[model samples]
Target: MKIMTCPFNGPRPVSEFFYWGEIRPMPDPATCSDESWADYIFNRNGAPGVKQEWWCHIASNTWFIAERNTEKDLVLRTYLFEEEL
Candidate 1:
């Protein structure tokens, strides 16, 4: 079986992690434009490179950031939500 290494934990089954979505253009809903809101919600560009992404640790009940190598199925880095500035 394929396993993934969660930086918060150790190696584990891929099922333990849930892909929340891409992390970008997180705008303030109150002042955001219709076009910007639509783009943020409906558009997605699955580019392969270093990017910030949201992921839920289903097995651990934690929200965190993940630096994913999209083309390699590799998680370059992961940090808890609390770690954010």
Candidate 2:
């Protein structure tokens, strides 16, 4: 029953959003070894904390970032890709 604000569409039901994985920097593939590249593609930091992640409004297919706390399942804020740090 949680409501999430979409940067383009304003407030919407949480059900309308898809939880994409955490936003992390991709290693430089040109210089990265096979193991490192594989790690980058397969590994995830499972630590609990406020994390910036990608979420899409499925109905609109619009993508945005949400700063959410894992422990409480609380979303601190949501913004467009360009609006983030």
Candidate 3:
């Protein structure tokens, strides 16, 4: 079975977690055009590569960020949002 390490709860079953999506920077609303905001909301990177994503531990109601590789399906690290970006 797959396992994911939760920052608060330690390692747990992967099934206990929920994957949100990749972390992307939002375009500056003040300076960005309509097309830029549209692209930011609609487009997603589907390519296989390392990316930081949002994850939640359902049982504990804990939300965190996970750095994972899509190609290899490996989690490099996990941390809370308040932690270093």
Clash count, one per candidate:
0, 0, 0
1 or 3, greater by lDDT: 3
Give the lDDT of residue 48 in candidate 1: 78
- Write out the backbone clash pairs for model 2: none
- lDDT by residue for model 2 (20-81), tens: 98999999999999999999999999999999999999999999999999889998999999
Highest lDDT model number: 3
How does candidate 3 score on lDDT?
Answer: 0.96
Candidate 3 error regions (>4 Å):
none
Which 10-residue span in candidate 2 carries the lowest summed lDDT? Answer: 76-85
Listed in order, each prediction's TM-score against the native is 0.78, 0.91, 0.91
lDDT of 1 by residue, 14-80 (tens): 7887888778867898999999999888888866777778887688866788887788867787887
Candidate 2: residue 17 lDDT (0-100): 93
For each candidate in the order shown, give its overall lDDT on alpha carbons: 0.78, 0.93, 0.96
Off by over 4 Å in 2: none
